[model samples]
Target: MAAAATVVGLGGGAEKQHAECLPTSCSKHHSPKIRFPFRLRGHHPKNCGYPGFDLSCTPHSEYPVLELPFSVNVLVKNIDYTSQTIYISDPHGCFPRQLPNLNLSASPFQLLSNYDYYSDLSFINCSQTQDQIWIYRYRYQIACLSDESHQVYAIDSMSLPDISCTKMYNMSLPSEIFGYSYGPITFDHLRLNWSKPECGKCEARGKNCRFKNNNSSSTSKSQLLFNGSTECFDKPSMGAVLGPTFLLVVVIAIYHVYRSNKMKKADQVKIDKFLEDYKALKPARYSYADIKKITNQFQDKVGQGGYGIVYKGKLSNDVHVAVKILNNVKGNGDEFINEVQTMGRIHHINVVRLVGYCADGFRRALLYEFLLNNSLEKFISTDKEKNSLGWEKLHDIALGIAKGIEYLHLGCDQRILHFDIKPHNVLLDNKFTPKISDFGLAKLCSKEQSAVSMTTARGTVGYIAPEVFSRNFGNVSYKSDVYSFGMLLLDMVGGRQNTVAQNTSECYFPEWIYKRLDQGEDLGIQIEVDGDAKIIRKLTIVGLWCIQWYPVDRPSMKVVVQMLEGDGDTLTVPHSPFASTNPMPTRGTTGGRTFNSELEVISESE
Candidate 1:
């Protein structure tokens, strides 16, 4: 399995420092090599490893302590980078002492449980007379139990002595220490496995792996080095070396050229085959000439955004459509097809419908149902448009957006997380019904999984949840969309962009709204009637609830829909989201407050 490349959040200087460190290093006392996904605390910077793999080295101790998930620390005995497994030992040398409290429920590591490699030891308590009699019944001595208890304990449950004992219990442990005991206590070495940062393949390819920063960007990618040589000694016949002979060199050079061309064509063929399969699966595929005919040679431009430009077009049936011609696509038309397959499978009143797509050669475009009202951005820009919407219409739009998001999360066979959920992505139809659009950054995972691993940050800066940027806030999950939805809700209420800098003393809208709510003030905004005021209050309270600092604190979209539909007066205000006058939490630090229970404390660099 290829390990996922994690784009960690770190400063340029710190990231560069870790990148410059040796690819593989060893502890001063031990020879176990440590590399990416397992960095030594003082030797390598925190960004060198995945979250929760920080290794702390002590001057006197022979083994380094690995900080596992849930903050449990264990001594590392050896690590097999090929198998992605680690042999660990208890620091106290008595594993049974801590077995009662052993918990890896939420950690990324799992204890080895293969029955062929482990056996069970049953701990039992019995009277002196019972112990003496059982020692005779079973040829194996039961005296290898706890010395303090002086009770006969069965080493293996399958071969019990057939004698009765009180309070008998068993635990499965690694069989490596089956015959080894230290004065009636067994050894405590165990094995654990992790599937992050699959570097074994890189090593097998005769390359070194490390986290490399491109320019001075805040994100980093896992890079492999070939060193201008192919030393694949593991494979037969390929291990033979080439000597300096004119004829032999020519043959080898030709082979290398053939191999390079073969690999490049292989990659292109894979992408082509994938696109071909998608075309066969869906009827939405359109030819380039057909797109030109439908779009009338790109005549009328309707709207434009960062992803692409939208043009008004008419299909053969006389139905109007909006065609988006992608601009500056980064990779192999994956994003284009992603949008096609994602929108094609979805069917909801509040979700935009995909009519067809054009993936002919290099030209790519997506055809969607045309909406007369443009986007929610235009309606919320001025007071005239705001009055036209009224509080009732705006409330309905809010609820509609929530329902669309809920559908994306729960209604689909696979849970789709729309990373970007700003106002611009929400379009309004002729009836003012809002539908979610622009799924270029969306991710799909099994409905059973609460979180998905992301290689890079996907959403806009202002609306992105803290966890998306840093794992310290929490794991990136569906709750991230709720945070963006919260920001959009606040933007709708204030009739201005939440990220914009204000000229007045107030820096952000959330802080100002929180202050008003805290003081039991009437919001002091212009309102036509008591009904409008009540609706505004409900939206504000729900917005605050959605923007809670921690993902766990934010309500899910399902709950958000319920809150918007429920009575305003009965709703309870959430805890202070903008707790301090500062509108946002400090980016680089943990804020000096203990949220250990709320989030996993992986590393200080996050």
Candidate 2:
């Protein structure tokens, strides 16, 4: 009985440690407990806190100071976790001196002004005279004995005079603490409020929360999850003790059988549920026999990719359609359903329409309108085809893609973020009009939501936004697609053959393009003629604007469309889309290094 009790106790202790192991900063005196979204810099890893929430613990002091934007450091007095507010005070007890020309432009926090009163300070440089009678009405004067000519006074007011003060700045404070001042009230605290962390939602559901690193995966962003249990352990069963050797043998046998059966059942259930949900959607469903009849037994193979094979087909009414048969299904058919769910809800001229689907047992396929021009990939990847399509046609295709993406973002009932936006995904009809096709890696969310939590990285590597791979760049949002679109435009300018362009020894292709454009060099168009230079320049500039490192710096799809459609002469060159460490070479030499691959593009099955 003692041994059994000991075993259960150890198990419970392990569970407790797992749940409570989140990095924390505690205080011996007054500071509040700091954990997620507020981690001590050296004491915790960055994932344990929000991006800008870097708290520094002074060597021997119990208080932790938070550094806000513009390097303003404030000693944290108290933190209200539920309210997502923090009370801070000047570390040296000199509020006026510490907060001169204060600016919170770049920080995540906002100053909370709950009071009605405001104090305006006027700095004067004049001899003390009876004309300063109004200065007596205000609070104590701040002046140096050596500088008798200058006088400064601060007072609360609804309105102030247009006096000829040398300098002036205003400070707003809560009315409760705005007592009649004889001296500067330096001990008053400032309240700051931040939107509650996204992880808070996981905790609200009664589950333990932890940030998961997702660099190894290609589908989701690193975010919080409700996977771990909040409680230490489940209660052990109460029963008579059996012989140790006999119990151990029984447990081993049962575990092996249970694990095998659990694996089988889980996989089966996942596939069944996926298909059930796919059927519930409004799109038409076709049987395998019907798919074979439609495609004429896969006779005409138009394209083949890693995930599936595409064949040209025609319906009974002689309406031409393309059938994509998914051949290498990795797991439970989530990718197929993701495409179905995403493409079904969308309806736009620039967005490819999903006519129907085929999910007969293990055999699955998608039916789309047959496009004669194939993909933009063929046109951009080869020089002969690119010139044949001409720069004018390419510009229109880029505009079409932008319009499609804009409609996906704002025109829909819910915002659809296309994680993967590339040239191959853009298909052209017989008339050369482009439509966006693939949606296996799409995410949908409300229009009001600023950012979406992803479990792993999505989109191709060269095109992936910095924030999508690492949160240090910024939050992943609709702008992530903008970054990919920027890469797409750059690819268009480079004729798609020079994407990532390692042959030139350049770290990034956009840097190379920027140097050419800034120097007024021809973009090396194979067939440069009248008005061709302006169109190429417009695409390059718009692409650079879209690929800014920070999501905030990138323009929206609507603005991108306007830039593309408007006069190219009015457009300005954007900041070079290259990191400072890899500065552009003034000599313009490749240094003989070649070969570049950004996680290898996952080619769409036509």
The 0-to-1 C-alpha lDDT of every candidate, in the order given, reads: 0.65, 0.64
* Cα lDDT for residue 487, candidate 1: 88
TM-score each candidate: 0.49, 0.48
Model 2 agreement with the true structure over 1-606: per-residue lDDT tens digits = 000010111111122222222334435455666665676654455444565666766533456777653335677888765566789887666655645535553356877756644444443334555266566565445433114556555554443455555445555545444455565344456788876454444445533334444122542322332121112123222232233433543664476467556767676565444333322213456779989988999899998776688899977443578898987665676666766766766657898877678767688899887888888888888677878888898999999999999998888656788888988889999889999987767777777646678879988878899888887776788888999999999888786544444465644457767777778786676655688788888898888878877676677787788778887777776656666733331211012211111211122221
Candidate 2 stretches with Cα past 4 Å from truth are 1-282, 327-342, 497-507, 581-606
Instruction: Tell me how many clashing residue pairs each candidate has.
Output: 1, 7
Can you write out model 1's per-residue Cα lDDT over 1-606, one digit (the tens) per residue? Answer: 001011222121222233333333333335466666577654455455665466654433456666442224567888876777888876666555555434453345777744547676676666665646445433223443445545645446776676667645566666655444422434455788876556667566755444433232544432222111111112212223222222333554476467556767676565444322322112256677878888899899998888799999877443578999987765787766766776776767898878778887688889888888989989887767887889889999999999999998788656788889988899988899999988877777676644567778989877999889887777887888999999888877877644434454545668778767878887655697569988889899888878887777777788789889988766666657754643444221112322223422121110
TM-score for candidate 2, please give it. Answer: 0.48
- Evaluated against the true structure, the overall lDDT of model 1 is 0.65
